[model samples]
Target: MNWNQIEGNWKQFKGSAKAQWGDLTDNELTEAEGNRDKLVGKIQERYGIAQEEAERQVDSFAAGLKH
Candidate 1:
């Protein structure tokens, strides 16, 4: 799904996001609120990954979602 669609249906996708990144906390997800950059930052911080790697993972996650 596209980022706009994901942003629009963030609540519905929250579970999937949680499943994808188990290290993420509820507050972190809530803080992201479907913003790709915010989510990437949270993931980077939690996973100790590079921003580029986090972005790649988040992009892959979004691509895997059903429209």
Candidate 2:
């Protein structure tokens, strides 16, 4: 799904995101507020990964969701 869809359905999809990144807190996810860039940045910060890797992971996660 596209970012718009993800944003709109964030409440449902947040669980999937948490599954993928267990270290992420609910508050951080709330702060991300379904924005792709914010999620990527939070993942990068929490996971200590490179921006590219974070983007790739987020892209993959987003792609796996059913619309």
Write one digit per residue (lDDT tens) for candidate 1, span 1-67: 8999999999999999999999999889988999999999999999999999999999999999997
- lDDT tens digits by residue: candidate 2, 1-67: 9999999989999999999999999999988989999999999999999999999999999889997
Compute the lDDT of residue 9 as modeled in candidate 2: 87
Candidate lDDT values, in order: 0.95, 0.95
Q: For model 2, what is the alpha-carbon lDDT of residue 4?
A: 97
Error of 1 at 15 (Å): 0.5
Off by over 4 Å in 2: none
TM-score for each predicted model, relative to the true structure: 0.97, 0.96
